[model samples]
Target: MTYWAAIARKSFQGGSTVEVPLPSSPKLIGASLLPPKHDPFYSQLFELEIQRHTTIAKRFDFHGSMIDQLMALVSSKSNVKNPTRVEVVTALLNRCIVNAAKKNNDPLRPFILFMPFTIQNLLNPLLPHKLVENYLTFFLVPIPDEGDLEIPTLVSNIQKEKINYFRKYKGININQTISTISNDTEDFKQNNLANTRLTTSLCGYQFYDMDFGFGKPEKVSIGAMLIKYSMVLFDSPCKGGIDVVITLEEEVMPNFEIDEELNTFTSLDPSY
Candidate 1:
């Protein structure tokens, strides 16, 4: 039987303690979900369409309003109104890593992203207590030496890698993978878990909008962690907007805050 069919059967039969659905199966390969195994990825807040950049180079600028303009470019270029947030970020981060490499003069400088997935409804009964947070460790593979590539190509490359990752690690024991990384430092290095960036998701999650028969929450947050180089993606309280929280080092914070490209689309005032 196919791996997904087996998972479904186990989920219904109560044969397994963790009923990871087919969708969540790929992420179940371990490494990204455990915080202790990897460094903390940062988060950032981008204001919506606060400004625009005229130059083409500024579109992918990490420090400028380019990030705000990025979605529009991707949407228009790909003809997709609501492209996947994780995919977009993955593409942007890939470019950022490459740009940072040139600035830092490191040819092999690679960036990794730790992304989370929601598996709340994977179980048969869909009990709240059974919910599990699964994640994937994505390596920002090096781009070719060719000239500037488009966003669609960027998105497609990462998507293809995801499929390849699943096929390669199919049927691996998730718990064993985690334990191996925790116990064997060499294994962790081989898995590239030590050098990955972190990202979290709250898409389609509306705790901020939950009325509970009372007024909506004035503020909602996951609370701040001292983690650096991590990012969290959330469905913004504002309609048709997304809120990002990026944490960076004190020295790097200044560069990102004053980034002309980023601030173009981001509001002047940031929450954090």
Candidate 2:
């Protein structure tokens, strides 16, 4: 057998894989025949239509020293200990977004932040090496509606939620959760998934190391922000720094841009 084929076989035999059932219908059904439902996933599509017209994108650069200072501050707090760079940054951005929403007089609703965690390492025993495909699991973090919480508290809350999720899903429980969520349409429909924010970090992906025959890129960016209420984090060209891209309603962008707390750590990237 080919070397690649042998490796694939071994991975499947490792017993970490979960079988996903096929969809109930192979053919597309007419919308007219379908019952109208208020699934958040489908509702977001309609919201996106309005968002595309009224949302704007902004990019901010956080210097390495500033990041260090923020991390130090977070560490000093008694509530949360040894907060990672990602957690600190996520907390800060989430707080800023919530504040901006309040400034815009947006309606009060529970906020859910969806963060993706890599599961490739978790399956290391099953696969000898990283596969050239997306292997991820998502955990949702609930953000407080009141944005007045201190940075340390925010970080602590996030850390606690993550810990609880991990403890509840130790080992193959995560695979089962993913399988059920993916296969059960009724469960998804019943859950309220609105007011959700998406976050992704491209750090440690080594984008700066790639060469396209013209030498390595000086900077990397996620060109356009198509999703509202989403944040993308990238490793800055300089080491130990991060570039954040945020999308919000145009009305809220002005207040968010000039947020006192946010401005203390980040500077607007004029090049963006």
Candidate 3:
């Protein structure tokens, strides 16, 4: 294993970044997925340790100065698997809880949650009740009023987990009130999936256009880039809502990084 691969495989619990060599082969015989994500096993135990120590790291508050640099160095650039803090946390919660559900085969278990803007406020009145379970609760990265958050491990973890688990499991009984994207109606045929209530709340205007302070944008749009190379999104509220979280790498946020070389490759369409 190369140095980067070895570093990525090692648990990254605390740092902002870790340099990792790209993996030579697709298969990681024994490497970890990625680090700085709340390791489910580690988190469950650490929650107790922090409580025991009674020093500083409080529940849901681990980013303080109390954690050492070595602990923080876990977030690495591992394209071989999940490579960001957000990706790792989402994967852990998704895997451990979904694995538990699949083990028991629950009839109404939800592996991937869809908190679409069309259905954000539609969670059941008892929805608060579901969050108490380890599998159910998901953290929401608080975007500033302008719409962007810094740390991303918690929500990113859920997205990775949902995508992987549902992609593998063929079908799931989801109670949803979808306002759009109606292509997959077959999954809930005869079932009351449609009856599952959903609601949404929209806020703010698409202000990325008027760049009052940031200066004229070389490019701008609704922001969707899924290619292998660099991924650029200038918009706010990236994935589901208005919050976009990516690694602190130029490969992920090109404009934010501002490299003159890659600037030549940019193509712009205002209508987009």
Task: Find the 10 residues in a row with the least total lDDT in model 1.
Answer: 48-57
lDDT to native, each model:
0.46, 0.68, 0.28
Better of 1 and 2 by TM-score: 2
- Candidate 2, residue 164: the lDDT equals 62
Tens-digit lDDT string for candidate 1 (174-255): 4444543344334334544334555665666766645432346765555433455556666655654455665554444545
Give the lowest summed-lDDT range of ten residues in model 2.
26-35
Q: Which stretches of candidate 3 lie over 4 Å from their true place?
A: 1-85, 98-180, 184-272
In candidate 3, position 109 carries an lDDT of 32
Please state the error at residue 148 of candidate 2 in Å. Answer: 7.5
Candidate 3 lDDT over 1-272, as tens digits, reads 13333444444423546443343443432112111233354244334433433221101111212122212432432222333332332222222222332334533332222222221223343233212111121212221221111123433443454454334322322233221123233332323321121111112434433432234344333332221111222233222222222122122233322333212222222233
Distance from true location, Cα of 114 in model 3, Å: 3.7
lDDT per residue, candidate 2, 1-272, as tens digits? 12333344445456756442222322223232222335576566457645555778889998888889888998887467688777788888878877887887876577677777665444313432423435555667766557525678778877886786555445543345455334444433454555667788877777776543345679888865566777888889877899999887788888889999999999999888
Candidate 2 error regions (>4 Å): 1-53, 167-170, 173-191
Candidate achieving the largest TM-score: 2
Residue 257 error, candidate 3, Å: 39
TM-score of candidate 3 against the unseen true structure = 0.20
Best by lDDT: 2
The C-alpha TM-scores of every prediction are 0.52, 0.74, 0.20
**How many pairs of residues collide in each model?**
24, 0, 14
